[model samples]
Target chain A: MRAEHIKIGTSPPISFEVGSGECLAIDGPSGSGKTRLLRALADLDPFSGRVFFDGAEQSEMPGPAWRGAVRFVAAEPVWWTDTAREALPPDEACRSRAVRVAAAIGLPAAALDQPLQQLSTGERHRLSLARALADNPKVLLLDEPTSGLDPAAVALVEELIRYRLLSGNTVVLASHDAAFSKRLANARIALGKKPLTAHAP
Target chain B: MSYVALTYWDLVLASLLLLINGAISFGFRLNLERSLAISAVRMVLQLALIAVLLKFIFASDAFWPTLLFAMLMLAATGYEVASHQSRRISGWRGYALAGGPPFAAGLVTALFAVTAIIGAEPWYAPRFFLPILGMIVGNALAGAGLVLDTIADGANRERQVIETRLALGQSRFVAMSDIMRRSVRAGMLPIMSMMATAGIVAIPGMMTGQILAGAEPGDAAKYQIMILFLIAGATGLAVLSAACGSVLLMTDERHRLRLERLQSNGSP
Candidate 1:
């Protein structure tokens, strides 16, 4: 996946590329357009630039198709449905994969059947990540994936993401966790500074 | 029994009942006296003007005049629908979006009823065509307005929920399915309740009017049933179309939520 001269909300034009099995970390302060950049990459926001996935342009494919391949997981995700299981994709394969991801993320399989209102904030956040991972997209745009997790759960999430990377998926994440970013990202970019810089870790 | 004419003195006597409301407003210091008086006067004038206009249309009984009047009524309905929106689409497009579906649905349904069902001598006969169009348009105006309001407000309130679905690769229609369903239900609620309680809870206005005009009770009831069915059909179509139209306006071809298209009416 690659973006060329992408501009979001008065931020400097951002350009970056990540290959298969690679992770790119976007580190910035609060209100620094990290989430906005991810949204643009997911094609969920209107941004000026060209994004290419596997040699096809973002605009070339339909929005849903592109987003399905390159999914965006918000820091605080939203669930429209009532139960945790209902929030995952309704297909059989996705549901099974979601169960596995849930278990791996330290969420019990029974938690999937519980109503969303009963779940804690951290539980909901983990469930949201599990839901995105179940889709197994080519690229994952994760915004602050480890913000609400305890050290144990955060380690588990790191392991899950590493497994995803081993299986040849690319990831671009924005986070304030310096240790997490250093461990995961091969290349990094910092926003909010003039003339943004991208460099290898 | 023949239809009894209402004299001006009878209207004066009946209007005296409004004083009860005025007295209540006064006693409570509700500050509603001015609005109540203006509303009462406005109602009287509007109804009186409509009666005179209907008399003129009935005397002429021509197709063009009837069509012209129907179009005018539809335009007014469109304005009313647009005005009901708390988060209105900015420009003339707002009016078009609010009014277009109901106008098409109401006009088509009324014309079908007049030409095919009633089989009036001249299909566009002002008396039959105008009344049928008025009822359908009136009901459709309410329905379409409700639908627009619900959809616009829901879109604003559920921005995160909807955008999350979009981010999950759901199509715009799929992302909007819940709100669309709710809006359509809201639009149809009034008509549904009216249908449920039509004969037992209260005699419907059309039936009552027909009975007072010396028609047989059975015939009046039959006509009422037909009108009710027409209203249900028209309102359903209007609401469904309004939902679809609103969804189109709220999103783009890229399936991004374009909430910026909606301008807030500045109310909390």
Candidate 2:
């Protein structure tokens, strides 16, 4: 995944590239455009720049197809429907993989059938990541993915990120955890209030 | 058949009924007296003027003047539609969104009824054309207004849910399909209820007018049914067009939910 001169909202223009199988972390304080940056990468927000995945420009592909390839997991995830299962796209492969990943995240298979209102903040966070991963996207954009998780849950999620990295999936993650960035990301960028600067990996 | 017209004395006695209603409102402290009085006055004046002008129009047999009057009525209805919305969409967007569909749909349906359904001699004759056109335009205006109000409320209430769908790779059409369906249904509800209760529970105004004009009861019933069908058709077309057009205005070419395009006062 690659972003060339990507400027989102009022933040400064940023340019970066992550090779296949690489993990990049966006580190910033609150209200520093971390969420906006991730949203721009996912094509969920209007931005002035170009994004390319696997030699295909985002504008070249249809919006649905492009979004499917590069999925976004919001910070405060919104589950529009009543159940976790309904929030997922109806693809046989994605459904099977989602069930497996739910179990891997320490959730039972029955969790998918449970009502969304029953899930705690931590559970909702995990389910949001699982929903995005279900599609097996080429580039996964995550904003504060482990914000509300327990230590054990955080470790489990980090392990899942490692697994995806090993499988050659490109990931762009936003968080305020410097240690977490060192632990998972090979490239790092810290965004400030007025401007942003990319740090060497 | 000849019918007796109400004399000036009969009309004077009818004014007593309005005075009685106004007195009742005042005694009850219902706060409706002022509005009731104002509306009564406006109704008398407007209807009197229309009756006089319509007689002249029917005698003149000129197409342009009649068409011009119909357009004036359509413009007023559109203005009323926009004003009724709680979240006002102003400027040309407001006018086009609220007015365009009803005008187009009502005109087409009215023309079809006069020419094909009734086969009125000289289809543009003001006597038949204006009345039928009034009925279609009035119903369609209300339906289209309901559609616009529903969409405005839905857009405000369902912002996050809609954005979720859009972000999940759903097309703009697919993302808003549920809300659009609900809005169209809501717009059609009043007409549907009227249709359901037409004969048994209530007598519609058109039928009452025809009867009062000395038409045969059976023939008046037939004409009422025809007008009711035309209203349903025109409202359907108007509501459909209004919902679809408003939805398009809320999104962009990138399939992003452009909620910013929606006017908001920054409250939840």
What does the interface RMSD come to for each candidate?
A: 0.6, 1.4
Residue-level lDDT of model 2, residues B161-256, one tens digit each, is: 777677677888888887899899998998899899998897899898888889998999999999989999999999999999878877778787
Q: Could you estimate the TM-score for every candidate?
A: 0.93, 0.89
Please give, for residues A1-201, the per-residue lDDT of candidate 1 as tens digits.
999999865578889999999999998778778999999999987889999999999998999999999999999988898887887888989999999999998999998889988998889999998888777789999999998889999999999999999999999989889999899999998787434448744
Docking class of predicted structure 1:
medium
Candidate 2 stretches with Cα past 4 Å from truth are A59-61, A194-201, B7-12, B24-35, B88-90, B264-268
**Candidate 2 global TM-score:** 0.89
Q: Chain B TM-score for each model?
A: 0.95, 0.92
Error of 1 at A43 (Å): 1.4
Q: What is each candidate's fraction of native interface contacts (fnat)?
A: 0.83, 0.52
Q: Model 2 fnat?
A: 0.52
Worst ten-residue run, lDDT, model 2 chain B? B259-268
Instruction: Tell me the tens digit of each residue's lDDT in model 1 across B174-232.
Output: 99999999999999999999899999999999999999999999999999999999999
Pairs that collide, model 2: none
- Model 1: how far residue B212 lies from native, Å: 1.7
